[model samples]
Target: MEASEPLSGTCHCGSVAFEVSRPAFMVACNCSICRRYAALWVHAPPASARIVEGEGQTDTYIWGDEQIEFHSCKSCRAVTHWTGVDGARWAVNMRMVDPADLEGLPVRHFDGADSWEFLD
Candidate 1:
């Protein structure tokens, strides 16, 4: 929310591109895959997430109840966060963001894997 600034992030191929209008509230989900992936996520409405390109290159991995559709590059296997079940929002990857644009952002960890709501 820093002054309502925006930042840009892209995949290694530069095929997929995205922009963030402001610094996002980062979340560190302690779910098994999340901890292993070690991604800092920025939750935003799906409209805020624009796939400038690389639509076909995106791969999906469904697990558990198949809620979050984890998207990653098919070539490099670089994860780009996830789109919600009905595509309501996007939880974008933090590492994709430029360091300078993300100054003073706070990150929180959630026990998503153990939570009854998230876990079966």
Candidate 2:
């Protein structure tokens, strides 16, 4: 996909949907919860990512420091995106995106499990 193209994705059951600009890079976190969810996060400004559908059809989860809220599709239990509690930051689960759309994106591995540093 073109760098300027938008990346759109939906939950497994299509209950939630979103669109974000092609991110400069994606993050693969190895933290406990992140590893379980297998989420590939792509961060963007709050205004840069848009929740296009199922605004009220998701369940939210907050743990640890509760600094972020993770939203998932209620129907399919698919993690979709996360937003900072402070509301200034946001990210989408790029795993929901088509593999074809993410062909050439750089992925950084984050060691959130311990030192909380990027492994790569």
lDDT of 2 by residue, 1-120 (tens): 567778899999998999998887899999988999999998876327899999889899998999999999999999999889998898899989999898888999999999989987
Candidate number with greatest TM-score: 2
Write model 1 residue lDDT over 38-86, tens digit each, in one string.
Answer: 8887778622556666777888887778888888888778787688787
- Candidate 2 deviant stretches above 4 angstroms: none
| Weakest 10 consecutive residues of candidate 2 by summed lDDT | 42-51
Candidate 2 global Cα RMSD = 1.6
Candidate lDDT scores, in order, read 0.73, 0.89
Candidate 2, after superposition: displacement of residue 34 in Å? 0.3
- List the candidate 1 regions with Cα displacement exceeding 4 Å: 116-120
Score candidate 1 by TM-score against the native: 0.82
Q: Estimate each model's TM-score.
A: 0.82, 0.93
Whole-structure CA lDDT of model 1: 0.73
